[model samples]
Target: MKRNFLLLLIFVLVVIAISEGIGFQSIPIGKFNIGLLPLVFAIIITMVLGIRIFRKGIIKKIYSKENVNFASKYLIFIMLPLMARYGADVAPKLKEILSIGWVFLIQEVGNLGTVVLGLPIALLIGLRREAIGATLGIGREGELAYISEKYTLESPEGRGVLSLYIIGTLFGAIFFSIFAPVLLDLGFRVEALAMASGVGSGSMMTAASSTLVARMPELGETIRAYASASQLLTSFLGTFTMVFLAAPLQKFMYGLFIRGEK
Candidate 1:
C-alpha cells in the first residue's frame, strides 16, 4: 500500500471540486447552443492526468496498479444507485414503453448495422482482419467476451476489439453528452433520440439522456424511462445479433475486403 492514499483522494477531490465549479455552460453560435457539462471536463481532465506521456513520476505512482484496479473493479457497484433510479423512471412509463415494444425488438436487427456500416470504413482505412472485431457491434463488454472466447485474445481480432474498447471507454460518454443535445437542436424528436441513446451501453445512455433532460426538463422522466428501457433491450438483443447477423456479414465483407470475391 502507498504511504499516503489521501494524496490521491485529495487530488481527485480537488479535480471534482474545480470541475463542479465550472458547472454547465452553454455557448451560443448562431441559432444553436454548444453545451458543456462538468462531467465532460472531469473526464477529460482525469484522462489527461492519467496519460502515460509523462512515463514515470508522481502521476504514475498515484495511478498505481492497485488503485486503478480497485476503481475498475468497483465501477459497476458505483453505478448501482444510478441504475436503480433510472429503473424507477421506467416503472411509471412502463405502458408507454410497452406500446413501442415491437419497435425496440425490430430495431434490435439494427445492431447488425455496425458490421454493415463500419466494415467498409475499417477496410478502406487499411485495417486487416482486425476489422472483424472492431466493427462487430461497438466493441463493448459482450463483443470483447465473444471475440476473446471464439478467437482468443492472443489473436489480431482480440487486439482490435480491445483497442476500440479502450477508445470507447474514454470518449464514448463525452461524445454522447455533446451529440444528443446537438441532434435535438438540429430538430430531432426527443423520444426517438432517447430510444437511440440506449445504444447498448449504460454510461453512454446516461450521458445522452442527461443532455436531453437538460434541454427538455419537462420531459426528463420520460426521456430517462425511454433511454433506460432501450438500453436494456439493446444489451439483451446484441448477443443474438453478434452470433446470427454480425458473423455472417463479417464473413461476406471480409471476403470482399481481402479475397476480392465477387
Candidate 2:
C-alpha cells in the first residue's frame, strides 16, 4: 500500500510538471540537472525500496539463479536509449496517419542519435542480448509484467535495479556528450548514423534529441529538416517492434541463463 501510494504521488508530481512546463532548464549540480520530475520519480522508487527494507529485514540466503534473472532484467535499463531510437524511426508514419505533417522529424533524428550513442555502451557493459530487446521494449511488455508478478524483486532488490539503470543511463549520456565532439574533431563523427538508428519508441527523448541537434551548426540546415522527418518515421514502426519482439527475447534470455528455475 505504501509503495503504491509513493508511486501515485510520483505520478501526480509528473502530471503537475508537464502541465506547468517545469523542466530541467536549470543545472543544480555538475552533469545533474534540478529537474523535479525525473528526480521525484527516482526518489519515489528508492523510497519504496527503503520502506520495504525497513519492514522486512535482510535475507542472507542467496539464490544465484534468481540473482542472475534479476540482473538480466535489470539490464532493461538500456531501453532508455532504445526507446529513443525506436521513437525516431517511427515518426513519419505517425505524421501521415495523424496528418501532423513534416515538422515532427527533428525529434526522431535526435532520438536515433541518442540511441546510437547509448546502445553501444550498453552492449559493452555485458548486458544480455535478450535483455537488450526488453530495454528497447521490443515485444516485451506482457513478458515484463509477467516476470514482475512472478519474480518479484523486493524493495531492496528493486533499489539495486533502479540504481543500475540510473548509472547506466547517465554513463551512456555523459560518454556521448564528451566523446562526440572528440570524434567529430577526428573527422569520424557519425551523428547522422546515430540520428538514423538511435531513436526508438520514446517520443520524449526523440524530441529532446531533436532540440539538441538543432543547436549544432555542423548538422546543417537541411539536416535539421531531415531530423524532423526522421522522427516522424520512427514513431510508427517503433511501437510495432515493441509489441512484437519484447517477450520472446526475454524468454530466450531466461532459457539461456535462468534455466528451469521457479
Candidate 3:
C-alpha cells in the first residue's frame, strides 16, 4: 500500500509539473475567446494514459489494480483541503452572496430537475431501477454518498449513480469548459454564467470559471468569487435537497411510471 501510494503521488506530481509547464492558452473566435487551461490538458493526458490502448502495456504497471484500490480509498482525504479552499473563495464575495441569498436557496429546488425530467427518458431507454440513481441529480459526490448510504454501493441504484459519477468526473469539466464560453457568447451575463458554473463539482467549477476569467480578464476576480460562492451554496444544499425532495419525488414518479406501463 505504501509503495502504491508513492507511485500514485509520483504520477500526480508529474502530471502537475507538466500542466504548470504548459500554463494557460486560448483561441479567438470573433468576440469569443476559447480558453485552454492546463486542467483540460491534464485530464486528457491522464485519461489517455489510462485508456485500453495502454492497459496491456506500460501503464499496466503504473496503474496496478492494488494501486487503483489504494488510491480510491484515500481520494476523499485528498479532496478535503481543496474543497475548503473552494469555500474560502466566498470570503471576498460574502456581501454579494448574502444579497443573492434567496437565489441560492431557491435554485436548490432546481436540483431535482434532473430526476423530474430524466426519469421518463431513462425508463423509456430501458433503465428501470437504475433510473432512480442516475436521475437523482448530476451524480456528483453528494448523490453518490446518498445512494451508497441508502442502498449500498453494490445495489442497482448504486450502479446507476456510479455510472453517472464516472461519466461526470471524466467529462463534466470538459463540458463546463466549453459550455460556459458558449453561454457567454450567446450574450449571457458573466455573473449569471459564473453562478451557473457551480454545478457542485470542484473540477467543473474551476474549468467554467477559468474559461470566463481567461476571456474577460477584467472580471476575473469577480468570476472566481461568484463561481466559488455559488458552488459552495449548491454543494451544501444539494444533499438535503436530494434526501428530502429528490428521493420522495423519484419514488412517486417511478411508481407512476410503473403503473402507466402496467
Computed on alpha carbons, the lDDT of every model, listed in order, comes to 0.84, 0.40, 0.85
Q: How well is each residue in 1-262 modelled by candidate 3, as lDDT tens digits?
A: 6765676778889998998799787767887767778898888888999987776654676688887777678878877887887767778878977988888777778888998899999999999988888999999889998999989889889999999999988898888887788788889999989988887888889899998998899988789888888788888888888889999999999999888542
For model 2, the run of ten residues with the poorest summed lDDT:
55-64
- Kindly report which residue stretches of model 2 are placed more than 4 angstroms away from their true locations once superposed: 1-165, 168-172, 182-191, 194-218
Better of 1 and 2 by lDDT: 1
Pull out the clashing pairs in model 1: none
Estimated TM-score per prediction? 0.91, 0.36, 0.90
Better of 2 and 3 by TM-score: 3
lDDT of 1: 0.84
Clashes in each model (backbone N, CA, C under 3 Å)?
0, 45, 0
Cα misplacement distance, residue 203 of candidate 3 (Å): 1.4
Could you give the candidate ranking by TM-score, starting with the highest?
Answer: 1, 3, 2
| Model 1: per-residue Cα lDDT over 115-180, one tens digit each | 889999998998887888899988888999999998987798899898888889899989988888
Off by more than 4 A, model 1: 2-7, 53-57, 260-262
Q: Ranking under lDDT, best-scoring first? A: 3, 1, 2
